[model samples]
Every structure is written in C-alpha cells, then in structure tokens.
Target: MKSSLFKISVLIGIFSIVIYACKDKDNNEKLEETVLQGTATIYVDQTLQPIVEDQTAVFESQYNVKLNLVNQSESEVVNALLTDKTQIAVLSRKLTKEEENHFNQKKIIPKITHFASDAIVFITNKASQDTLIDLQEVLNLLQEKESKIKALVFENPNSSIVSYMNNLAGVKNGQKKNIYSLNSHKEVLEYVSNNQGSIGVIGLNLLVQPFEDTKQYTDKIAVMSVRNVKSQPNNVLYYKPNQSNLGEGLYPLKRPIYMLNYQGTAGLGMGFASFVAGDIGQRIILKSGLLPVRIPSRELNIRKEIINNK
Candidate 1:
C-alpha cells in the first residue's frame, strides 16, 4: 500500500506541473508590456506636465498598468529616447531626421502622434502695465539688440522654451545679457512677480490650467498678449494663447505636442498613444485649456417622446 501511494503521488505531481505550464502564457509573461495590462515608463517634457498628469491619472485609474512618468527638460527627454534609456517620450517638438535615423538603424520605427497644440507664453508681474509684447522685440532682445524689456526670465536653460525662442530668434550662441533662467516655471513666475520690469517666458499650459503648485502664482502674474512685427503695424493684432487662437492658427508662438513610441510591438506605449489620440483623450485635452488634435464631437440624443420615470 505504501508503494502504491508513492506512485499515485508522483503521477499527481506530474499532472500539476503540466497544468501550471499550460495556464495563460500571455498573462504569465510579466516582463513584456501589453496594451491594457503591463508596465511602462514615459519621459515627458516638464512644460507639458500639467495636461499629461491629468491624462496619466485617468489612464492609470482605468487600466491595470503603472506608468512611470519622468518629467524633465525637453533635451533630457530626447536624450533618453535616443540612448535607449526609454522607448517612449512626450515632447514639444518632433524628432529630427538624424535622430529618427538612429532608431531606424536599430530596426525600430518611430510612431509619432501629434496629440495637441501648445504655445510659448509671455507673462509679467500683475502690477506691471506691460500687457502686450511684440514678438519681434522679444526676438531682438534674444539677439542682444535694443529692446524695451529690461530683463527676461525663463525656466530651465535646457527646457523647450529656450530652444524654441533660440530658434525663433536665430541665436546660435546663447541668450546671455538680459536673459536669466530659474530652476522651474514656478520660480520664473515668482521671480517675475517680484521683479519690476521683468518678463517671464513659459509654456501656455502652466499659465492656463495651473497645477496646485502654480495656483498661487497664477493670480500674481499677468499673461501678455503677443503681436507679430511682421504683420502690418497699423493692423497688427495682439493675440493671447487661447483655444480660438490655437484652433484658427492665429497664435504665432504655437507648437505641436508629439508622443513618440518605439516599443516596436503592441506595448503599453502603443496603448497610451492610442488612448491620448482617441476621442476620450482628445476630450481631456480640450477641457485642459489646450487644443486637441481633433475636436471631440458632441452627441445630441433626440427622442420622439419623453417619459418621466420619476
């Protein structure tokens, strides 16, 4: 009877091994990131943090995945993507041809999704009388030419705002002289609010839908409307960064927001890209005081008759 029991136990153990081996191979692979259930790490440009945070919170609540969001400067975000530190990034600009080639050489095709529209914003102390800024004058100041502005404050030197303004001003060297940079956008706001005759350049999202950290500074700083000098002087219009201006392409400082995915498979990046570019994600953008890629359609349900259940 002891020998019979031993043989029976061995057979049962073998059966259990087979059952475990056959069980849900798809769910068992924890290393791979899937569409709805897995892990992912995304690097986001700090300027776009507010809106991305809203999307991330909603995405995490609805899905069974954890997204490690690293908000840093635009250059850092791009470097992380090129060096393969990460396969996904949210940027204020697109990858250059050379940058794209680096990934292509590794047999990874980049999938870029233009999700929303954002712009560079100019702000000043609330007590200041300068409510309008000429884009040309700002560019002139960047080039070290004569300008009305006393000092210009900006976020991190490595941030996208610096790159965008440098490119626009055609300044290859550096914005030294009257230009200064703080550690963060909120610091710039605080500096501008305290300093007289100083202007702060930041992303529009920070000024529009401010996070809790920036809420206190929102009321202290005044957003300046920008006018393009290239337009006829008499008919020039100073336009603020707003939904109407962004949608109609009247905002001169506007830039496109992109999400580049190089996961090379149906990974969590693909899932997030689809989610942000989809109807629901676009709606989130629309409500965040940013311009969505495609406007979310409004549904009107009309019934032939109405019934009062109550």
Candidate 2:
C-alpha cells in the first residue's frame, strides 16, 4: 500500500507540472493585447504633433492603454519604421511604393489608415500687408525663380512641408537663395513674427490649435490665403486652410494624414489605428479644426409637445 501511494503521488506531481506548462503556453500565445488595452509607441510627424496629442489624451483617458508618441521630422519617422525601430507611425502622406516593398520583402503586411485631411499653411507676420499669395508665385519661388516672395521660411530640409513644396514646384530641393529652413515650425513662426516680408510655411494644426508656449507666436502671425493660379484663371479664388475648405477639396495645399501599422499582429498598433479612424477620433479631429475622413454622425432629439411656463 505504501508503494502504491508513492506511485500515485508521482503521477499527481507530473499532472500538476503538465497543467502549469499548458497555462504558460496559453499565456505566451496572448501578448496582452486587446482592442482597448496595450502599450504602444507611436511615431508621429512633428508637424502633426498637436492634433495627435489631442487624440492620444482622449484615447488613454477612456481606455486601459498607454501610448508613447515620438514626434520627429517626417524623414526620421520613416527611417525609424524601415530600420525596425518602430512598427507604428503617423504621417501627412501615405507610404510610397518603394517603402511598401521593403516590408513586402520581409513578408510583413502594413496597415494604412487615412484618418484626417491636413492642410499646409503659409503664415506671415501680422504687420505684413500681404494677406494672400498665388500658387504660381509660391512654386516659382521654390524653383529659384524671382517672385514677389521676399523670403520663405520653413521647417528643416527633411521636413514633410519642404518635400511637399519641392514636389509641387517640380524640384528636387529648395536651393533658392530666398528659401530658408529653421530647426522647427516654432522657430519658423517666431522668425516670421519677428521679421517683415517673411512667409512661414507650416502645418495648419500648429496655427489652429496653439499650445501654451506657442500661443504668443501664433498670435503674431496670420495665415496667407492661397490662390490656385494653375486652374481656371478667371474663376480663381483664394482659400484659407480650414475644415470647410479641406472637406470641399478647395484647399490648395492639403494632404491626407495616415496611421501606418506594421506590427504584424493584432496589437496596440491596430487598436490605435482603429480608434483614430473611428467616430470618437474623428470627432477629435473635427474639434481640432481639420477634416476627418468620415464626419462623425450626430443625433438630435425632437419634442412633439411643449409645456408653458408661468
């Protein structure tokens, strides 16, 4: 009977070990990721930092998740993604074909979520009398051709705005003598504010929603309305970068903002992308003065009977 008891005890210990092993296996299968729960690092284009910060604040407050956003220049963000430093990024434009093929070679599928429409804005010192600029003049100035623009200040050469303007002007780079690049958008705005006849090219998000420290800089600058001179000359009209103009496709310098996920699993990247493309996220974008991909729906209540008050 003692021998039998010893054998039974050995069997029970083995069974317990097997159970614990299976539990460990199950836990390993799940990476602790769910729709509203997980930790993620998101790389955002520095120009879009303000708007994204608004989205992340609301997202974390309502969900059991923590998001760490690394805001850098557009090139830096893309380079980080390519080098496998990160799997999530937000940019003003979608990934190019070459960038997509890099992941394709690695058999990693990318999820691109276009959430909002953002505008590239031209700002000038409030003291300047020029309130509007023609698209041709801007392009010509970028091409190193003489134009009415005295000086064009912008973010660094690697920034998305510089690329957008260069692409518009059909140039590889902005080598114009009058073109100047600063370390950041804040610096560009400050320079424009302090200098006369300097147009600061910046993202609309910065001007529309100013942070506490940047409010003074924004207060001293004015958005320069842009006229699309390439289109019908007689019917040309100047447009300010605003939600209405972006939604109507009337804004001359606008781009789609995309959330790119290459995490390859149903991870935090997926959750944040869905959130930004969802109703609540869209509402935040709307409140941020940009155009959301889908305007969040509204519900109204109607009263059929009214009571009179004495």
Candidate 3:
C-alpha cells in the first residue's frame, strides 16, 4: 500500500509539470503574434510631417502596417535615436562623424535611406518687391551690425534651417538682429503673408501639394531666389524653387534629405524606409517640387521646329 501511494504522488507531480510547460509555450506564441502585428513609432523633423503624413496613409493601405509618427526637431530625433527612444529617424542631413561613432561604439549599424532633395526657399509677401537676393546680401542681412529686415523661420528650438543659413551666408560672426523665429511654418507663412517687409525662409516640402490645394497659399506669398554669388557677383540673377530648377542644380538653397533606421530586421523603420525609397515613394517626392532619389522619367515636349531641324 505504501509503494502504490508513492507512485501515485510522483505521477501527479509529472502531470503538473507538463501542464505548466504547455501554458508557457502558448504564452510565448501569443507574445510573438502580438509583436508581428505591433505598431512602429517614427520620429522625424517637423518640416517633414506633412510629407510623411500623406505618404503614411498610402503605405498603410498597401503594407497593412501602422505607423505611429511623432514630429519634432532634427536634433530631438537624433537624441531619441541615441537613447533608443525610437527605432527610426527621418532628417534633412546625414549623421555627423561623432554621431556615427556613437552608434558604432554600441555596435548599431544604422541603415541610411536617401529619399528626396529639398531646397530652402525664401519668400516675401506677394506685394513685396524683394524678389531676389545675392548670397553676400543674405550674409550681410544675417550678420550686419544693425539690421531691420525681419527674418522669419519655424519654432523648433534646434532647427537645421539656422545652420544651413549660416553655411550659405558664411555667418560665423554671430546671430544677427531682427531674426524673428516663429512657432511653425504655418505661422511663418501667415506672418509673411500679412507683413510685406518680413522675409520667410522654409523648406520646399511645405509648398508641395496639389496645384489646387497650394494655389491659395503660393498666391499670397512669392518665393525669392538666391543668386550664385561666386559666379554672378553683383549680378542679381535669381532662380525660383521649382522641380526643374532643383533637378538642374539651379537652386542654391537645396539640401539632401535622409531617413536613418537604427532598429534593423523586421521593424516599422525598415518598412517605412523601403516604401519611401521605392518607386511610389519617389513619385510622391516628385510631386512636391523636390528631387526624388530614384529619378523619374520625363516626357520631353520637343517643339515642331526643333524636331523638324533634327
């Protein structure tokens, strides 16, 4: 009777162990399924919000993946990537050597995807006569001892606009007077639209939209052109910011835009990056008066005279 009782006790213990193992396996499978359907958070420069917002809707429809996007300054995005706060970051410029080294030290190989090229455009009220400015004039405007010209920009605390301006103007001196950095591009547009004397500088992505959607805004403000100072010194020949101009390298204010993915393999970052660099992604960029990384084919309209001569 004692031997039979011991066997029963041991069998019961083994049965309980098997049940617990089965439950643990089921729980792990459920967790993995959740991860496969999970959402991805993408942190990007504020200026690229509108561009991405539109692209996200289309990407979701095709990929069945959701993008949880957060808009902030480029600097903020960089900081988040360093802290593992985000998996992907879209920015106007590539990472610096120091930043690259930081990731390398951590054994994180960031995937860089170049999607579009945008030009920083300067605009004044439609009624204002200041249509063109030389690089020297812009430098003086930003660095002059006493200046009254109000230069407007977005509200982000750390913006690439300021740095890009400094590079173009060679303004190593210091902050100039009358630089009224505003809260957002919308506010900058409104302020410049209302005030004729004020000049607004912004990314070209802000102006990209369907012709009907953007006509009202573009009509209110006229974009100014920056001349090639070294090539055309004292001559104020200005080239407007347009898709053709950007492609031809006529826009002096143009800058390359990139998307950096720190989280590798099967993450939301890779999904979005793939979409933006693909054919569809590039088409969207082309619509915005910016140059896409993947060049699109253009239909050349040859005039009858030229065609006949050839």
Worst 10 residues of 3 by lDDT: 29-38
Question: What is candidate 2's TM-score against the reference?
Answer: 0.88
lDDT of 1 by residue, 168-199 (tens): 98887464899998899989987887876678
Report lDDT (CA) for all predictions. Answer: 0.88, 0.88, 0.74
lDDT of 2 by residue, 1-310 (tens): 9999999999999999999999999778754776678778999999999989999999999988899999999999999999988999999887889988879998998888999988889998899898898989988888878788777888888999998888888899745688888898878888988987788898888788877878888888889989976569686689999888888888789898999999898888888889899999999999889899999999998989888896
Task: Put the candidates in lDDT order, highest first.
Answer: 1, 2, 3
Q: Which candidate, 2 or 3, would have the higher TM-score against the true structure? A: 2
Taking all chains together, the TM-score of candidate 1 against the true structure is 0.87
Global Cα RMSD, each model: 5.3, 7.1, 9.6
Give the runs in model 3 whose Cα sits over 4 Å from its true position. 1-38, 145-157, 170-175, 210-218, 234-236, 297-310
Residue 12 CA error for candidate 3 (Å)?
36
